[model samples]
Structure formats: C-alpha cells, structure tokens
Target: MTSPQPLPAYSRDRLAERLAAGPVVCGEGYLFELERRGYLQAGAFVPEVVLEHPEEVAALHRQFVHAGSDVVEAFTYYAHREKLRVIGKDGILEPLNRQALEIARGVADTTGTLLAGNICNTGVYDPADPATHAAVREMFTEQVGWAAEAGADYVIGETFRYLGEARIALEVIRAAELPAVILLVAGHEPVTRDDVDITDACRELAALGADVVGLNCVRGPATMLPLLGPIAAAVDVPVAALPVPYRTTAEQPTFHALRDPGPTPLPEDLPFPTALDPFTCHRYEIADFTRRARAAGVRYFGLCCGAAPHHLRAMAETLGRTPPASRYSPDMSKHVYLGADTRLRAANQAYRTSL
Candidate 1:
C-alpha cells in the first residue's frame, strides 16, 4: 500500500470549544430512512447516492440543521471501502466519501452549523490476523484523510460493535489530529458485540484520548438510559447518547433482530419502516430523556436510526433553545392534548350510553 497521505491543517480544539459552549444535537441514521423512502436501494445500501443524488443528501442535512442540529454529520455511514466492496463499488470509496463531505459542508456553511466527518464499522477489522489489522488501519486512515481534506470540524467513529474495531478507528482519527467521538453499539446486557463491558470499554477509549465516548445505534433510549450513569462514572470526557428512536424492548434490544430473514413483511404493528411516526418519542418524551440524561451527566445527546427532523426540534426545544427554523411560538397548550388522560377522558365522556 502507498504511504498514508498528509492531512490538511485543521483545528483539533474546535470540538472541545463547541462542546464547552453548549450541548450538541446531532442527526444520524440516514441510510435506513433514505432506503425506506425509495431514495436508495435497500439491500445494497450503497452510499454512492451522495455522488448520484447530492440534492437528496443535502436536503436531509438541511432538515436536520434547520430542525436544530448543532452538527450536520456526513451521510457516509456505510461508505467505507470494505462495505462498498460487498456491493461491488470499492473503487469509488474516495468519491463517495468526498461527495458526502462536500454535501454536508455545504449545508453546514449555509446554516452556520458544524460538520462532523463520520466513519462507522468497516466490517473488516480482525485482531487475530495481522493482515486484517493493517488493512483496517489503512482503511480508516484513508477515510479520515478525505474528511480532513473536505474541512470537517471533527471526526466521529460511531456504531462500532467491536471494541477492537472502535479502538482502531479512534486511533486513526486521533492520528489525523482531529477531535474524535467514539460511540459503541450495546445490547441490553450492557456489553458490546464482543461481550466487553460498556463501562470498561468507555474507560479504555477515554484513556486512548477519545474526545467523547458513549453509546449509540443498537438500542433505544429506554434500554440505553440504564447504561449511562455507569458510563458517566467511568469516564471523564463528555458522554454521548444517540439511541434509535424505536421502542427497543428487552426482548429485542437491537434493531437488527427485530425482523426475520427473507422477504416476509414484519407484522403490521411492528415499528420497522414506520419508526419516525409510530415508534418515535414525542417531544415531551424527548424532553424527559434529556432531563434524565443531563442528570446523569451526559453532555452530548442525539438520535440514531429512525430519527426525523421533528425529533431534533423537540430536543432543542426541550433544552430551551429555538432552532434555525422556528415555526411555533413557545406554549404549553400543545402538551395539554398529548397524554393518556386526554384520550381516557374523551373515551369516558363518550361511553355513557353504553350502559
């Protein structure tokens, strides 16, 4: 392999400066939503859409940024070389990442929002094999280099299931002299895919100089909330919680296990494709989680898969801030019509003739 390219000069202290000012509201989970809406192929999950359909990608970023996202993450979740290779598009990794960053940069520049260069699980890291380890490092180095070249404010290594793989990505991002956020995917057991304890993992990543370390993607807020206190106690850096918007129950801690194999449709009640509307938390619920997370010392907060613009809007409102696009005046009237009591009262009033 050729020598790793030199990264452009960028401020490594920007993320820390931004975080110190206030909480960060990020918008993630573009692949699942884009595919469900017919913008991209479902099974292939190719990220060339950034290059082929830049408008659509930029539009999504605009929605999040307008909805109060502090950071507009590049839609490069599965854009890694190895992931592209699975779909026979390995040769376009550079273009895919570069275009994705460019789109995100444009949105951020227009809205005055920060841009995060994203890198997720590469699906090629193996601690047991020396060759695989070298390949994994090189893959991350190349990706981070592209992001730095595109003027990303910081780099986030998220949704990594394996501690080793997450560490590798963190190392590469740090080597680029950019602030790094490392997010791990956890199950109900409070352990990673490799069975390492989450608290232990956070401590290790923090020790390795991760600017921010926390959990995301595998479980919903209800499931991930229980793990936050321990992680906060384990690490000194800010804790991040970007759970999926779905109601991930104990029976199905992770979203991937929610569906069976084959083309069979999930049960109508299942909140797979319709997560943004059905399974997502209301603004009040997001407010409640934010309150709890703040109490738990979690500084960075956002949504993972199944997130929509409204979710970010609610989060920002709950934090007592208005987004760039403020449509409604601050009022408690909407909350009055939102709970079970309102529905129960209406049902009770209408059922008098049933006797």
Candidate 2:
C-alpha cells in the first residue's frame, strides 16, 4: 500500500465554519447514572431501550449548557444495535439514538447549545479477530447514520481502546461525510496492545481522515503525559486530552466500577482519600490535564470515563481564560511531583553531566 497522505492543515475557522457558531463543547464523553436511577442489574450500564430518565438527562444537558458548553452530547454511547439485540430490541436503535439526540437538541434549542452525536467503543476490540468486526460495523454504520441525519453538528468516536476499531468507525463517519473526532485510550506507560502503540494509533487514524486526534480513558492526567506528547507532535490536527478519574496505582481494580448497592459516593468516599473528590473527580483531573495539555498545545478539550457536567464546566472556565482564535505556548518540558522532587533533582543532575 502507498504511504498515507499527510493530515491537512487545520484552520479552526475552517473547521468551525462547518459547525454552527457557538461554544462548541461537550459536557462529558460518557456519564453512567444506571444505579442512581434504579436501572442497576448484573451490569446495567449497557441496557436496552436507553432506560432514560428523561427529566434527569435533560437537566444534565441544561447544566452543561449553562456551564458554558456550546455543545451538549446525547447519552447514546452504548446504544448499539448488537447491544440492544442482547435484550431483544434490535428494532429500537434508530428511535433510541434519535431520542437521545432529541433530548440534547431540546435543551440546546432552549439554551442555544449545539448537540453532538456520540459513538463509543463496542466493548470488544481486535476487530480482526474473525467475525468480530462484521456486526460492529453494521451497528456503528446504522447508529452513525442516524446520528448524522438527526441534525447532529458533529460526531465523536470516543473511549476507543484500539486503533483498528477507531479506523473502522472513522470510515463509517467518512461514509456519512460528517466531521468527526477520535478519542483513543493510551495507558499510563508506553504500552502496546494488539501490536499498536496508542500514540502511533492516533496519528494513523488522523491520516485516515479523522478531524482531531487525542486521548480519553487511560489512568488519569498525571500519568497520561507520556502518550500525549507523540499525538500532539505527530498529528497536525487539533489534539484533545481527556483523562478519566481512575486509581493512581494498581491496588484497586474496583476503584472505577461500583461494588455494592450503595450511594454513589464521590471519589472522596474513601476515608483515606485526600485528593480526588468522587463527584468532581473528573474536574480535578481535567483541571490538571487541561493545564498541561494547553501547555502542550492541545486545543480541543473534554472529559471521558467517570466525567460529568461539573467537569465540563471547569474545562470551559479554564478555556475561557484565553479566548478562541489565540495560539498556545507552553514552557516546562518536564514536571516532577512535589513528593519526588529530591529524587528528580538527583536524576536531573546525573543526566545533565552525561549530556
């Protein structure tokens, strides 16, 4: 195959020109209110028929719009055809996706916020793994087609763990010819999954015609820095950084997933927790991620797993400090944790002399 073409030069106005003039932002990439609304079961997060609490969902959109998000995304990430088939509602994909978009559009109309149609990971990666991609592509094409037809300004293919899957979704978006952005999952280290470095994956997807290349999910803002550098430099398009509120260490696998039928405690639910708040955890991470990302020249910003309207509000506040149409300039290539300053100093001294 011939070498891929270079990514087109990005002009924010040219990109924004395709979209209606507005704040043009999303509150969060995904928000799960399953247990809170009594939809909890074995794994109620992926349920059939949307299980939408209409008033609550609408209110969330309004909250984000009021918080200054120009775009409000519908809660339709997992509403795929195959997912619905498990619960025996294969016919409702169009309606549910439409309803989800309508919910956001209703609030958008009232508050003048743009609505973004959201598509998410199929929960199963490695599409090349025999018969894996067939159904997912059909489901995504149907869902994305509906999203494009439902007056969505743009679509976000988010929280993707594999680049191959992202490219499939990107192709679907291209078929619809709707402007699109991709959010990949880059783990805390230089990890490779399915023989693809998460950072290289972002650049490849952009070459396939993704409008923006960035990251979402992964551990948290503190550890995602290693992956962001390559994506920011390799792709000429806008780079967005949205880290999830996950555990700092591998000690707790259940930190993100709920354990019991208990009140949804904020991140601070644990007594020993001193840093991240449960309810506003995404905001805390986003605050730091956006700060460093802005310094790294990332222009697009949003949240991913374990995010909410509050986090989006904080991101908007941070973005507003410097208006759009301005350029990004950041210093400090390296950052050391306050607790590790001593060791970092020693390491820096040794490396400096070697240089």
Candidate 3:
C-alpha cells in the first residue's frame, strides 16, 4: 500500500515582497499544457484534471519552477463555476478548486516558490444585465475565497476580456485582502470586449488597487508588446506581460486572427487553440521578446498559451538566470557538422554548408 501525501502548507503575502525585490516571472498556460499532455480537454478548458490526476498537475508546477519561474500559478485558469457548468461538471467545482490550490501549494513550498491562485474570464458577461454582473461577482467571490483559504500568496485575475469583469475579480481579491495581479486580454481591435481601450483598462485597474497590471493572453509578442509601453507609462505599479508564443503581425494581430504566410491553407483556417503550431515562436524569439519587454518597462514576464519549459528557460537566461534547465541550453560547438572542439573531424566540419 502507498502512503498518503502530506497536505500542502502555503505562506501568504509573499508576492509583494518578491516584486519589491525586482522583476519576477510567473509560469502560466496550464490549460494548453495539460491538454497537450492528454490530461485536459482543450475547448472545455476547465481544470478537472486536478481532481482526477493530481500528480500530473504537480509535476507541471515543478517543471516551471525548475525552468526559472519565480511564481507557481495554481492550475486553475478556468476553474470557476461558470466554466465548470459549461462542461457539465458544476457539482465538482469546490473539490477541483481546492485540489488545484493544494497541488500548487505543495510544489511552491518545496522550492520556496511564490504561489499564485488564478481566476479567468467567466464566458457570460453582459453590460446591460444586472443579473449577469451579480453572477460574475458571485463566481469570483467563491474562487477568491478558496484561494485565500488555501493560503495563496497572491491571486491572479487574468485574461478578462471585459474591463467590467476585471473589476469584479479585482473587487473580490481586494475583499479577500490578497495582492491582486490583474491582466486584460484585449482583442485585435486594441479595445476590451466592453469597448474600453486596453491602456485605459489597465490604468484604471491599477488605480482600483491591482498591485500589478498589464496585458496577457489572446495576442502574441508582436501585437502585445506595443500596448505595454502606454500602460507602463500610465501606471506606477510593476507591469506584467504574458503573451501567447506565436508570431502575430500588424495585419492579423491576435493569435486567433493570424493567417499562415506559407500559402498552404491551414486545415481549419483557424490556427488558434490546437492548430497554432506553425505560428509558434522559436525559443530565441522568446529571448528577444524578454529583452525588449524589459526595455519597454514590463517587470513581470511570462507566456500564456503555447508556453513550454524551454520558452521559460529562454526568458530566464535573458534575465541572467541559470535555472536547472539552463544546464542543457544549446551548445552548437558540440554538433558533428558545426563542431569547434579540438576532437572534431576537419572534413565533416568543412562540409557544414553543403550538407
């Protein structure tokens, strides 16, 4: 018989202390990652896997930490009641949220990592419906409560397309007395779903007590980087940047809006959620993004959808960190054809270009 794992013990209010020290990196994109690992359903995107496969969730948190993330965000990006109800698993909401926080909490304590509890968009938001607004607040209250009860160091309310919804999440996190990191996912139009401009949304959220505020999700490096400058200038707080790892351009800004340049039509003509491989940025591109974001005043760095351990390592190396994964960063000199080592064969080295 196997022994039971010890309950996770979390330490609170550490995220503010971390930011006071310097720029910090948080690992995100748990939904896509777990989906790629065959443990999650992509379209549903709810984190029921936390209840069914706790070890897998824990292992991902450890991987991000090992790759140089300063924070271990709980795998609860879409664990709210609204998302659970969409997937017909509303009955398991409490257990799923608790399990995700527990898994993340345990992993965070091991490496002394900053633990972040996550809550994302609620799918159902209406500008005119008072009932909808109440529902959104009710949902955030429960998730925020679970995070606080689970000892979250801070809570991240991310990818809110509507500034109205962002306000609700911020209000709840403030009431819980946890430091809040609010990130808005502006679409291709440079405005939130509610038509509030991205910069104004971030600035207002910062004014409303978001400890860290900036852009995250939907858009990639190219499209997302431009918005950071204005938001950083508008707010005194540390700015966060966590774009998806894709090659988005001016004409087709967001990842969902990207059109393949290779002239071969994509199978679905929609390269977002699962078919975004061709548009994924190389690790070196991620490193370049890190350097540029730092220059643009983005103090909190991460990747959203399409994030992998290698991308996080690249970001860390750019910031002069040597996380455990840095041990294997490419050494081209070791290559048989491109060798600079004394033991290399002259003929193979000389044939590099032709081969």
Please give the CA lDDT of all the candidate structures: 0.80, 0.63, 0.87
1-355 in candidate 1: lDDT tens per residue?
3433333444666678878998888888788768766788765677777988899899889888888888989888888888888888787888889889988999989888888998888777766777887888888899899998998889999988889889889889978888889999886577776778999988888877888999988787777888899999998999999988766667877665454433545556444544334455666676777788878989898998777787778887777778876685345333434333443456554453253
TM-score of each: 0.85, 0.74, 0.94
Encode model 3's per-residue lDDT on 10-93: one tens digit a residue.
Answer: 333577778778789988988898899999987877878899999999999999999999998888878888888887888999
Consecutive 10-residue window with the lowest summed lDDT within model 2: 323-332
lDDT at 87 for candidate 1? Answer: 83
Q: What is the lDDT of residue 284 in candidate 3?
A: 95
Provide the RMSD of all predictions against the true structure, rounded to 1 decimal.
Answer: 6.0, 11.3, 7.4
Q: Clashing residue pairs in candidate 2, if any?
A: 24-70, 25-71, 266-278, 267-278, 268-278
Count of steric clashes across candidates, in order: 0, 5, 0
| Number of the top TM-score candidate | 3
Q: Write the per-residue lDDT of candidate 2 for residues 10-84, one digit (tens) a residue.
A: 333334652333223556734443333444333435533244466667776676566556677777877876667
Off by over 4 Å in 1: 1-11, 259-278, 329-355
Clashing pairs in 3: none
Candidate closest to the true structure, highest lDDT: 3
Ranking of predictions according to TM-score: 3, 1, 2
> Relative to the unseen true structure, what is the Cα RMSD of model 1?
6.0
